[model samples]
Target: MRTARRWRHYLKPLVFALCLAPALWLAAGVRWPAWVDLGANPVEKIQHTLGLWALRLLLATLAITPLRQLTGQVEWLAYRRMLGLFAFFHVAAHLLFYVVVDQQFAWPILLEDVAERPFITVGFAAFLLLLPLAATSTAAAQRRLGRRWLALHRLIYPAALLGCVHFWWQVKADIREPAAYAAVAAILLGWRLYRRRPRPAVTGAAPTPARGSSRD
Candidate 1:
């Protein structure tokens, strides 16, 4: 209980650091040919960066419930909004890199690419879905919308599915990493479904006492 009570103070920083660790590592001059452009393929590097961040965010989102349950930390709910926002940030970065750098902001080329690439279409759809959820994550929006806010936010599940599909579809070889993420997502979604199932109710009928009456 004390751990639960004090969780809010530490949760945000811890989650943020965990999420940013990879990006920070890249920023700190870790120049792997896969990540850095020094004779490396820039497009692949950008894809790798964005894809890792997206998967990390998705995993983090799925982890929230399990972590909260284990820690008895209800206040961890406060971190969800920021965590979600960071996920959106990374996904948007992914999209921007593809659009501006890879496609060079050419609508004709982008349309052709999207049409030719089913994975791109799925990823684009997922990103579009995340936009509204991130936009309405504030307290003001929550208060204004009430139950409807929750209903809209439920799209996260499908968005995550679409994201996983996007990743899976895009990979040509060494699909182990994407498969691992998909497995994790399946387990998370399964856990959620299990939690939501209806429980059997106990009947109020009680057993009668023995027929022999001592008082008589």
Candidate 2:
């Protein structure tokens, strides 16, 4: 029973890895007709697909705290780092696909894309914001940076917001999906604010009588 109970701890990561298996296979040159199109590059589709997963994983990682609090499953905290690293993996893959396959090693084109495309700009900003969080994720960095590290990691909120905007801006129509993500992000952020709000102090203690003994 103990082992079975602990098995639940592995369930999320297992499911995530299983979901990503297809992407990994595709990345390894396993082509699928469902993903191929004569008008669109398969590589770009792969990159976009991976990028979407990255964004979802990032959101999931951010949701851990709220979900744990709501559910009272403190064990959930153990999975957050793994989910975050998986998010970074997918994001890195997306960036590499664009740089290597789409742009053909053209720095000029890459720079132009960042300058002209708002979606790209926001996505880039999100990636940049995640860098410090990822960097200080290690125990050594946490020890070295102390409280400053936590303050820097708080940038995840804005980073997530930028990621949502980047996704929403890229869609030309049928924005419901993006809007859903944005709503979720908003709720998560709102939860934090609500949780942090100061409450009125209770005044239950009876006022102490003035110090005047029977000397009266």
Candidate 3:
């Protein structure tokens, strides 16, 4: 009991700090860009890391549901929002790097990429979907929106599917990593569908109506 109590006390802050760790390390890497050798193509490396971590965190957010189901721990839901927000933060970083470092905010290049590059187009769409979800994750928004919040959040399904497609399309030759991400996404999505599937009705005979009551 004492151990569980202590764990509950520290869990939120620990998870919060861990979520921020990647951003902090990425910032340090930027400061020591030359000192830290990411790869032959540093820009690609940085962008890949940002996008990969964002996708990974997004998967983690989805995994919480299955994890809770298996473990019967409802508290797991508490961290889903944090994971999603961190995913969004990493995605924002990914875009900022592409815009500021790669494209240099060139309007022509940005427009051309979005229009011509399927990967960039779907990635941008995924980010656009995330914008509203991240915006309305607040308790106040939940209260104000009520059931509408859940409907709005369902946008994540398409957003994540697009994110997987974007990653798969961006890969040049080696597709194993992207394939794995896609597989994870498929499993998560399938799990949700499986859980929501309608059950077969009971096979028992219909019950008799009361003498005074007529069936509606």
Q: Of the candidates shown, which would achieve the greatest TM-score relative to the real structure? A: 3
Among all windows of 10 consecutive residues in model 3, the one with the lowest summed lDDT is: 207-216
- C-alpha RMSD of candidate 2: 10.5
Leading candidate by lDDT: 3
Residue range 1-216, candidate 3, lDDT tens digits = 345445866897898898888777767777887776665787777888899888998888888777766665556666778888898898889998999999999989999999999999999999999999899978888778877787898788888888999999998999999999999999998988886678777789554222111111
Steric collisions counted per model: 0, 0, 0
Give the lowest summed-lDDT range of ten residues in model 1. Answer: 207-216
Give the alpha carbon lDDT tens digit for every residue of 51-91 in model 2.
Answer: 78887888888897887677655656666777777777777
lDDT rank order? 3, 2, 1
In model 1, what are the clashing residue pairs, if there are any?
none
Superposition TM-score, candidate 2 onto the true structure: 0.81
Task: Quote the RMSD, in angstroms, for model 3.
Answer: 8.0
Q: Report the C-alpha lDDT of model 1 over 1-216, residue by residue, as the tens digit.
A: 566547757876887888777666555434565564323565667557767788778767767775665565555566666777788888887888788877789999899878888998999999989899988877788778877887888788888899989999988998998899899889888877876677666587543322111111
lDDT of each: 0.75, 0.75, 0.82
- The residue pairs found clashing in candidate 2 are none
Model 1 TM-score, all chains together: 0.82
Q: What lDDT score is found at residue 154 in candidate 3?
A: 78
